[model samples]
Target: MTFTSHARVDTDRPARYLKQLCSHFDRKANSTFDEEKGRTDFEFGVCEFLVEQGALVLDLTAGDLDQLDKLEFVVGDHLERFGKKDGLAVNWKRD
Candidate 1:
């Protein structure tokens, strides 16, 4: 009934990356980000992302298993772009 994913980024200043991501959705999606707390929360379709732990921890949830695939792709793509300079490796998987 529900699908969830988790990703931990091994990089310096992970919070900055998460903040960058949350900013991207500030205008379009219903979202909220707290850079100080290193947390970002966003709602996209049937999916939701909860990024915390200085951006090192990423939690994604969707209404259904199928929806999670697209959600994961979207999140991963954005993260890849943000971490491109540092070549940060983010390994996220269904959990």
Candidate 2:
């Protein structure tokens, strides 16, 4: 079975964060993104991003619970670092 998690990160600049994240991860993973949406394939799992008006939605999928948890932390931590000035937060719900 696959493990999954979702997070809606509130930020004033969703598009900017989305692009920033995709670009950063592209250096180490397979990432493709534009202004509205993006996807990244990491060694641990897959993360898909959607930029809304004032938030960035993240969907993460992995083969197991450990991978899912790792994916969530990695993505969320990077985003938090990137948006520290804006005080961004990523609260995830598992599925």
Candidate 3:
């Protein structure tokens, strides 16, 4: 199943954050990114990110039903890393 959330981070360099994310997961998983295109994909149900609407739209697939909570943790952790944009809160909620 696929789980997803949109994090509102009004940063001028959203692509930069995406690059950092791709780099963070670099040796551990299969990841690819095209910052110029503002898109990134990661394997093993990690997450796929798209920079849009002043937010980092995220789609994460839980390999199994039991992985839902784990997926939330991963999402929450990463969103935190991206930090708040313009002091705007980063809220993770079901899409």
* Top lDDT hit: 2
Residue 34, candidate 3: how far off, in angstroms? 0.6
lDDT of 2 by residue, 1-95 (tens): 89999999888899999999999999999999988999999999999999998899999999999899899999999999999999998899997
Residue 88 lDDT in candidate 1: 72
Tens digits of per-residue lDDT for model 1, 1-95:
67788887776676687677777866666566575433334453333434455446777778776667777777788888878888876677877
Q: What is the Cα-based lDDT of residue 28 in candidate 1?
A: 67
* Root-mean-square deviation (CA) per prediction: 3.0, 0.6, 3.3
Name the weakest run of 10 consecutive residues (lDDT summed) in model 1: 38-47
Tens digits of per-residue lDDT, candidate 3, 1-95, equal 56554445566666777777777766566668786333334343566677765565665665664464566566557656566544434555555
How high is each candidate's TM-score? Answer: 0.77, 0.98, 0.66
| Backbone-clash count (model 3) | 0
Model 1 global lDDT (CA atoms, 0 to 1) = 0.66
| Best of the two (2, 3) by lDDT | 2
Better of 1 and 3 by lDDT: 1
TM-score between model 1 and native: 0.77
Comparing 1 with 3 on TM-score, the higher-scoring candidate is 1
Q: Residue 10 lDDT in model 2?
A: 87
- Model 2 weakest 10-residue run by lDDT: 4-13
The numbered model that scores best in TM-score is: 2
